[model samples]
Target chain A: MEVMIMKRAIGVLDSGVGGLTVVKELMRQLPKEEIIYIGDTERCPYGPRPHDEIEAYTWELIEFLLSKNVKMIVIACNTATAVVLKEARKRLNIPVIGVIDPGARAAVKGTRNKHIGVIGTKMTIESNSYETALRHVAGEIDVYSLACPPFVPLVEAGELDGERVRAIVAETIRPLQSSEMDTLILGCTHYPLLAPVIQDVVGPDVHLISSGDETALEVAAILDFKELENDLDTVPAHQFYATGDVVIFDRLATEWLGQPVRAEKVEVSGVDA
Target chain B: MEVMIMKRAIGVLDSGVGGLTVVKELMRQLPKEEIIYIGDTERCPYGPRPHDEIEAYTWELIEFLLSKNVKMIVIACNTATAVVLKEARKRLNIPVIGVIDPGARAAVKGTRNKHIGVIGTKMTIESNSYETALRHVAGEIDVYSLACPPFVPLVEAGELDGERVRAIVAETIRPLQSSEMDTLILGCTHYPLLAPVIQDVVGPDVHLISSGDETALEVAAILDFKELENDLDTVPAHQFYATGDVVIFDRLATEWLGQPVRAEKVEVSGVDA
Candidate 1:
């Protein structure tokens, strides 16, 4: 009998260590498939960056992943996903995904009052990516968007839980308390690391939608629909890269992922755009 | 300014009123898209029928929906989906969806122990569709499938909640209790109507993966990816058809859907297979 080799890995890129939330879920949800992830921790918060700058950085990451011969690409950063998702899909041969849409879809399904809340980086909220995405597939939705800038920094520092985190979450999330939103989309990837704190602040009645978790489900759906899933029997070797502090990323990856992962440093400028 | 015309409706077919569960979700999640649903309530339980007969009946339903000029199609009946899904995709021009994969994907996502339980019609369980779909995406998954042949009749009889239904569900779902499955997929489309009882039987720790709700989310994701979603300003004009007892189907549709809907009768033989 002839042998059938395994297919190519899926490429995932993000602004920083946040995308590991997506990676963890992918590992759990689609264990057979291999994944390659790159986080630009050096230029970490893509949220405050200009549109052109964000797209240019995103395209470079795409090219590097393309060179690795990935079968599909997932823009795991909500900020970048909002800025460059449409263009990347048009430019690339592979199917490209955004974190925004999956969370939006899940929020639509989970909500009973059609009232949704979104908390993300300033750029993600200002771009109205969650609102646009939520309204694109769903109709007549009441969207309440808030920008939570401190959440990412907390995760990057490997500070997931404590009184400090809870106090910050309670104060920051207080604005949306009166919205009466039943489903809150954690629009930023790093937000999931603080999900328990966020969920606590939002109360038990409100469901928190994690972009990382929901995107993993969407990735599985796309693979099945496109017939691009890997049917390999070999153990998957997941690769992780960070542009800034590999030490910090490595520690957080191991801690958050519940597995040991060594992150390598990569210079974003060295990759061909 | 140029106006954009609305897209065509999505065609959905099932073995009987069980598929209305899917329709209810589609309405809730995707309020913009028009839906055309047909149920072969005459030959209601496709679960007991041979594969060849299921395919023939499904093809006739597909042809009727095609005549209405739908943009996409969904096989809402788990039994028919398992039998006809692959062949139908190969023959159809538009994207065709099945109820099994979505539930399988969700179960894989929701399960914490990598152990899952599936409860479906006899044919769906016997076909090993859930196991196939689950293992196809994720590796090393333990799936326990039970053929709850009595559950469908309970839903069809419109006896959703009562002590009698609770006793039947508790008895039928007892096999899965020993499986140590963290996620239990209601593999039959009709199962969602009976979800409260099933959940009570299985307990709260086990996450119930409703095929109808999951498929609705998948439908939204596919629509966004394919750009087949409707962007019309007009309210959707939904249509319902049944090959058997229109009155019974109509009553179930309105009651389960929580909306007043009139189902029309059609002769399945008149439609070309």
Candidate 2:
């Protein structure tokens, strides 16, 4: 039984390289556990898509992970988590965790003045997931949410730290300056890469909460609680699969995770059911 | 199915009233979910007991909660979490969460200089659970642990603030002033009540991580993941049980939770199996 639990890898899914942020955290926290990551880069940027389409794509990704017999599943993309987390949890018996609640909990806990801000894709902000979650944890707190669609693109383009990116971030967050939110939730997994620029724009007094780090912690606790942790002495190799250009995916994965990664392109067509 | 999910209460167990901190957090975060708390006050201060005795006492509490058809369980005491979390998860089918990992994760994330401190009873510090958990999440960091046995007793006595308590706190934490730990884990749930004095002694530069709050977040996340969340609109009355003096338990529970509590006494003699 112990060997079976140790052998089963954790499944992580994301819309694109954005999920790599969560994967990076999981790798750092659970070094002994094997990870199988799948990035739906072909349908990358699930933010702009309709809810039905996003749900379908997320289901396809989940199906692929289920095929690999993962002991647990992590929805690394905020957009996917917003749309499909409830339904997925209902259907699957294994543990399934998303990024929103963890981030919301941290933001609520860190905030002293009962005021918080959230920045994410348009769909995530529109869904009101963070605001709802924050209110669920902390009743009647002021939640100000903004849709920063351009942030993900800049992060994907590797424009993390420069004058132009900083200016864009500053201009985007200018409206929140007067809101006086002491804590801000980085609602998207991709936002952590742009943390320095965001921090500079938001000023030093505001705390930035990362969803990936919080999600990684939740995953670790769940792993221990479920007794699925890998106790083997041998080092485990991580596996990555993408439904888009393999070379680009491999490059981004390596860059974001700070390690050499060989991302393979696989066809996940007809998995939308 | 939804009705059944909504009706099942969350089971929380502790060595004594210290677990009320966790219960307080659960009431704050998951207001709609029903809670069934059992305090093994008859075997209070499990911290000084043998590991086997502690494990047996913890299982008795778990069995009592399981008899209530609880949807989940939270080990609110650090010493109990250190000794029984692994075995309980292996033996039970429902989700089981402990306080240590969540507190460890938050401390690791909150710290900037890779230096952290932990304060708990002798057993918790001796168990090395927090150190192991912190290392599991953030590799190669400096961990300084101190056993603050007197703190819990002071809290149990309701001596949260005043010059006398402050003096005790200052003297107790004087050793860590030079350690320069940016984050400190209130490893014991009872410590949060003394947070003000601890913060004053540790200085404003250090962040205090509460296991109760963090564990509450983990419980909320697990509830959503397991599809066991109570989404009903009606308010749920919380149930409390104790194995010691019912009047004292009720008084402490009412004082700490800032609400009226009806505590019932029950005998758990020969429950150690």
Candidate 3:
């Protein structure tokens, strides 16, 4: 039997285009690693879906990337990562990393007052996944979690900041402000995109941790530890695939990635598997 | 035969606390009416969820409100309104109203340039419901729909205007600005909260429509037609319920509603039925 070598491509999947946030950070942190991204725009906002459904959808994306023979898998979407990471790691041949643990670790490390705030999709918050992760490391630390449900949609629509976004920021986060937290975890991948707005709302004293950046660092460490770092001579390129409109994926990718992206359309089915 | 008089509250539900936005408008539009508002804080960001799940969840909320004997239902969430309004109307005994059609009607009536821009959740943009509503009323007009996914999270996190939110806004709406659209529709109920940021991003030529406010008008009209409008003689009271933390809800409600709101925690079950 011939052995297959893992390719340099780092596979990333989100319920939709928000995973580009991780891709954005991955590009900055690991410049030599090519990224193969799959955004399931066809059925996104995995936040509210039943656990079984989310698990299935996430696995489908993972299988697609695995079929490409990617070196590793990154569950970029917070909801998917929160709900399915363990199962994914168990099933995948290569290392499967998620955003929650890295983000929780960073928040734990960064907090000075022992008061840390966490924000993400409603389902993520409802699951208390971050609280669990934070408690696992530092049980006595105070973890405040709020679900900023509409945030991903706002980011996707491109209304990042303004009076409307500000008001919503004020409304959504008023809960955290009263708690007097010193550091806040930007738990959702889409949140870093709204860092300025969130920072302003939480004020200067609160430190905002972008899980995207932290997760990228985690990816780097895992790659180095496993001797899986892509060779430097290769020019890293990013390819985007979506089940939705290619024009939308391309526009969003270009806007998010800071470079022109041509997303190819893929016909994917058989997932009632 | 005995005739019984019953007191019924108007039901309003949003993906999250942003429906306080509709509450604000409702307070202004129908000061004497009692509002029974349900915000699905535990499972929000309905914009990105699958159509079936969104419909099921929205119906769940509707069923919950119906159990409360609500005279009318206001779907203050954009995604919920977009994906489930007709079905909701068909299923419920009370009058069901959504934000999009009312907002689209207002945009059609408000625009002088005949070119309108609509922004909301990804589901809202994908549905083209706003465009469909606008075109149905005025066949020759041009409509542009932009999906601003991150806006809600930014606003919920309390960042209205900041460098990060601005950069994201600039990047997302730049293409629309170049296209020369004059009137903009805040298609999402949560969007009006980000109106200032959107105005700054899109510039002054574009008029912003608050779908929340328009929906409030629809509520008022329906109330008047049905003779369900509350009398202004007594002090108006608004009741807020959340499946999540009451303190978080109260804090956000007070901030968004301007007046102090003491939200009460309520058990919500049988939403899917």
Report i-RMS for every model.
0.9, 2.9, 23.6
Candidate 1, what DockQ? 0.84
Q: Write the per-residue lDDT of candidate 1 for residues A196-267, one digit (tens) a residue.
A: 988888889999899888999999999888878888888889998888889888888898889899988888
TM-score of each: 0.95, 0.88, 0.49
- Candidate 2 pairs with clashing backbones: none
lDDT by residue (A152-243, candidate 2, tens digit) is: 88988899998999999998988788897999999999999999889988988999999998898788877876667777656778899999
Q: What's the DockQ for every one of the candidates?
A: 0.84, 0.35, 0.01
Which structure among the candidates has the greatest TM-score? Answer: 1
Any idea what lDDT model 3 has?
0.78
Clashes of each: 0, 0, 35
* TM-score rank order: 1, 2, 3
- For candidate 2, the share of real interface contacts preserved is 0.33
Superposed Cα deviation of residue A130, candidate 1 (Å): 0.8
Give lDDT tens digits, candidate 3, residues A151-247.
8888988999999998988898988889968889988888899999999988988988888877776676556434476654446677889977889
Which runs of model 3 end up more than 4 angstroms from their true locations? A1-7, A270-273, B1-273
Reference contacts reproduced by model 3: 0.00
